[model samples]
Structure formats: structure tokens, C-alpha cells
Target: MILKSPFPAANRFVTIQATMNKTNPSKKQVVVIGGGVIGVCTAYFLSKKGAAVTLIEQSSIACAASGKAGGFLALDWCDGGALSSLARTSFNLHRSLAQELNGKEAYGYRPLNTLSLSVTESENPSRGRKQTLPDWIDGPVKSQRTIGTTETTAQVHPQLFTRKLVETAVAEYGVKVVIGKVKSVETGGGKVTAVVDGGGVIDGDAVVLALGPWSSKFTLLSSVINVHGVKAHSLVLEPRDKDAISAHALFLSYQQAHGGQPMDPEIYPRPTGEVYVCGMSSQEDIPDDPEQIEPNPDSIRVLKRVAGTVSSHLGEQSQVKAEQACFLPCTDDNVPVIGEIPGMKGCYVATGHSCWGILNGPATGAAMAELVMDGCSAIVDLTRFSPARFVKRRR
Candidate 1:
């Protein structure tokens, strides 16, 4: 049976011969210790460079934060910080990958207009005057302000994008995938030699810890990096009036008429005719297994209540699709750790992206591949995001 892709046909094909030529004739074996966007992209880039890569995952690909994240891409949002150059480079890479993979239809890749809304008592602030909101947003909206334009803001179906990246690496470049929990990293001569798991030991010339929050679980890495999980809850609603909802993404600060703490909610209308809403976050303990994660009941209740009030069509019980939650990997400084770990030769780390993992996955992958094969990244400078930075801070 021919499996049909739910995404649109991407007729473009990426050329990896040029990149493969840059690497030395001696092929190196790489082990990527996660299956999220970052890990998949890294594996893809490495395979494109003619390296033998083994992508190991504890669960299915993109089944964690990568699959559940809101794939909002911004070119200038991280400007003025250490992530500016990284963000800019990644944003541009996203557009290129979209075209290369025919992601425009395959993964719902497209530009979007983002808006900021302020809720008020009056349902129609203009007293039924002309408003620019989509017909489906028949809520008590007082005002809407443009936050991001199509020029800088864009979106992608995170799960599909991630899955496609891994699939391409395997189908086109023969990248192997190992499904099992990594028990430990075996080392000798101060370099990582192999990854030990339940099934057996897989040898590698180099290893990367891209295990998201689970990176903290391994004694080998937890002693060095300060990475933790921040739980976020979200809901996907298949509204009955999908056409009435435009392509605008909304960041709303809703003030309850009864006077209480204002709730900040983010709403994204996907090209696949589904609406995603998320906001509440907490410093919850990271679970042992990704499958064991669950959304807080109170959080889901609040989201459903507010979502219904904001868009009546979304409130219909029949339209409710998925209620889920995931953990975002974070660091003490809030910047991602994406470089070779000091003292541990041939060992690298690339997690702690927090909320921008999906946005920066491709660039991180490209940069990591360069670093692993060419001794340095040809793209953004990763000095500020080095794993050694955390060690330096401790002193």
C-alpha cells in the first residue's frame, strides 16, 4: 500500500554532494542520543556529509517537545541577545529547508501574521463598528495589535518536519536508527567510544547528548550541565468553523470581567485546519519516561474555558481533538548548550533550547555537523552557547 502524505508534495530535492566533498575521505561514525527535531536534523546533516550516523531514541521520533511544540519561527525575535546570530541563521535555514524539502505543503510551512490582543469588558469595543478580526473570533475582544508580520514570522508543522528529516536521512543516506534507552556512555582515552543501551552496545567515534530534559538523567552529563524541564500544557481543537478562522496567530492577555489575574494565552491556527492553544507553564519534575507525562487537569480546564470564551466554535465538545503536555529543556542562563563538552573528547551536547528547539533545530543540526566533520561550524559562532560556559560560571 502506498502511504499518502498528509502534507503537500514538495517537488524540490536537496543536493548533498557539495557538502559531502568538504569532509575527509575517512568516514566517522556518529551517535545522536535523541529523536527530537535537533537530533533528527543533526543526523540528517551528518549523513549529508557522508558520515555514518546512528540515531537512538527512547521513544518514537518527535514524540516529545519537538512534536508537541508550537512551531513559531521568527527571524528577529532573538535579536540583541547572544542568540541573535544563531536565530537569524536558523530562520533563514528554515526557509531554505522548506523549499528544499517541499515543506511548503509537506509540513505546513508558510509565513504568518502575529497579533497581540487585549481583552476588555465590551464584546465589541467599537460598539459593533467595523473590525478586522476573522469571522470566527466572535469573542469579547477589545483591541488587536500587530506583533509580527509575514516578513519575519512563520510556522511549520513540527512533528511532520522532524519525521521527514529523519526519514530522508535514513532513506537517502542509509542513516541507522536504534530504538532503546541509553544506559551509559562508555569511554576510553578520554573520548566517548560507544553508547550502551538495553539491547546492546553501539560503537561510535563521537556521541551527542541531545536528549532534551532527559539529558539531566544521565550521570555522565548531569554532573556537568544544569538542564531541567519546564512543563507546558496545550490543546488542539478542530473547530467546526475552520474557514472562519484566518491565518493570524494571536498572543492574548485576557482580563476576566470579574477581576482576577490576567491569563496570557497563545493561539495558532494551522494550515491543516486545526487550532492550537497553549500558555500555562510550571517547574514540574521531569518524569522518568516521556510517555508518562500528562497535562495538569486544572490547566486543561482553564484553557478549555478561556478558549471557549474567546472563540465559540472552539468550545464545542465535538471539536476537541487533543489535550497534551510536554517538557521544554531549560538551563540556568536560558541559552541552549550546543557544543563539545570540555574534557570529554569526541563528546558533544545540544539541548536546553527551552521554547525555541523547533525554530533552531535545523541550524543547530547544520552547525553540529560542521563542528563534527570540519572541526568548526561554518555558520553561526557557538562560543556563547558552549557547554564549557556552564563550567566557567561555576568557578
Candidate 2:
């Protein structure tokens, strides 16, 4: 059987890596830029495939969206769309990765039930649990329905999950981690080099750019793909009765007492006994630095109010553990760009995952590994997600 690739010209590394793996003593070297879930996953899978990998990051691992976003995984939420196969593939991969990495202990991985409900804050909170809600959801909740179950919906502490992948990639596969702000890429002389702001260069047989929302900041990608950021805010609450919280993720349509527009916030309970509530997302200009991204006071206030209105345990009695925000990378066509850059052989790109980054990280990484090393991805078809489509639009 022969392998097929959408990136025909860019498969130079395929033969080089194959020849090197066969006769040359040294393994193929791959430089992966970005430290978010996508980049970390790519590096992890690349190293697993025997590539000598170096992961470059502008900040600490999982310090941005990967760290802050609600780690909600839905096997079918993205079904009936282009991401259906990818979501299903990654959901299973998460399960296997959990077993291999002891994810439950290391990253708070667990299956949970997901619900969609409507809540209208009243002057008085309900004292009794209704509609089979866990006793703690004392808010004026109604119209509750199960959207997902343990078999299909699950989660991981996103920050810990990304870090765990990095740790495993380093300890088990000898992948190196580099801290730097990548300024540009050099594709001259048959090698790809990542030039850092301070004049540091990391060269490799191939390179994968997973810059998340920062993809637009990189001229190489922005020249072809239109990647933008959506700023989203979230808050974490530590309820006094931790045990009262069950592994139930909630999708809420909330209307405050003085209602204007209904708000859609999501709630996820971590195994470590913290409840994370996130909403209030909008398209915004991304800051030059991730650390500089802070939550809007109004958005934070609204989310805090939503938490209290949803559950008394999460109301004034709960501890405000974290109030933060991050940007979700979106694309012009609302699909991820995940193939070799049209004309840059031995250089690839992966971004524009939007809100599905964490849910799809593992499979994305695995497919990228296969695409970079094996010349094709058996994990998922890359035809629909090829960057060439966007390039074609430009013609």
C-alpha cells in the first residue's frame, strides 16, 4: 500500500526521516512551536513517533487558554459537522491516554453527566432539589435535560493535562522544552529554523507551528489563513461542602432578575472539588502577550452572579479560587487549518480550533505526528482540513 498526502511537495521530510530511520544513526528532528494544548500534543506525538523533538513556548506550559478553558469533552457535540470524526477520535484517545498517564490522578480526568437547563434568578432561592438536580443546585432552575452521559462526555483539568503530556514527552521520549518568543521561521537550506526574539535558533528536519491565537501574529500563517481570537471569561469556586458537588457539567441559559439578554454559561466540576463556571465570550483583539490578557470586570461580575444564581453552595458561601480569561482561536471558515503550509515544504501549521482545542488535542497531535513522519494520517483524513483550500480561495 502507498501513502497519500495533500502536502505532496512538503513530504520531503518523509523520505529524509525514513532514510535516516533506516540507515542513518540519528533520528529525524522536529521543532514544535507553541506550548498550548495543540502544540504540546503535537510535540508529544512527534516524540512518540521517534522524532527528536524540541517544544518552544512563549510562556509556561498550559498558562493560557489551555489552562483556563473549561475542559469539557463531548464525543457528539461536534457531530454532524466537519469535526465529528476528529472529536470522536480524540475522545477515545483521551480515554487511552488517561490509562497510560494515570490521568485521573495526575490531571483530574473523569467521566461526567452533562445537562442543559434554564435558570431565572428569583429573589428567593429554592431550598429543595428539583428535577433530579444534585441537592446543591438550589437556584431557580428549570427545563433540565440530559445532553450527555458518562460514556460520551468527560473532562480533564486542562492545565494539568497539558503539563502531564509535556512531562511524559520529556521523560519517556526525550523531547526538549525551550522557553522563548518565536519571532520568525527560516526555511532556507533544506532545514527549518525557529528564530526566537533574543536571536536563539532551533533548527529541525521539519517544523509544526501551533501558535493558537498568536497564529495571526506570525506572518507566515496570517498570510494565508485568517485566524482571530475570541476573548472569554471564567471563574472557579471552591464550595464549602466539596462532596456536595457531583461530576455534573451544566450548560445554562440564565436570566438575571433584571433581565436583558439571556447569558449562556457552562459549569464543570473538577475531581479536586472545584467548580469552574465560564461564559461571556466575544471577538476581540488579542494582546501581544498571554499574561497580559485579563478578565473584563463586567464579565467577571456577571459570571460570579451566574454562579450564585445557579447554586447556593457556589454563592456567597463559596471561595473564589480563580477569576481569569483567555482567547480562543477561530478561523474565517470556522474550521481548523491542519496541513502543510501550501508552499513551505517540511513546515506545517495547526490552529483555528476555537472552543474545541482541549477536546480534540490528542487526535490532532496524533494525526500531526503521522502526517509529519509517515507522510499521511491514518488517524483522520486531512483532505478537508488542508491549508490549500484557503490558498485556493485567495487565487
In the order shown, the candidates' Cα RMSDs to the true structure are 6.3, 7.3
lDDT of 1 at 208: 82
Stretches of model 2 off by over 4 angstroms after superposition: 1-25, 123-129
Residue lDDT tens for model 1, 262-285: 888888889999988887899889
Compute the lDDT of residue 112 as modeled in candidate 2: 97
Clashing pairs in 1: 8-105, 10-102
Candidate that scores best on TM-score: 2
Q: What residue runs in model 1 are displaced by over 4 Å at the alpha carbon?
A: 1-26, 120-130
Among all candidates shown, the one with the greatest lDDT: 2
How does each model score on lDDT?
A: 0.81, 0.86
Candidate 2 TM-score, true structure as reference: 0.92
Task: Provide backbone clash counts, one per model.
Answer: 2, 0
Model 2, position 335: C-alpha lDDT score: 92
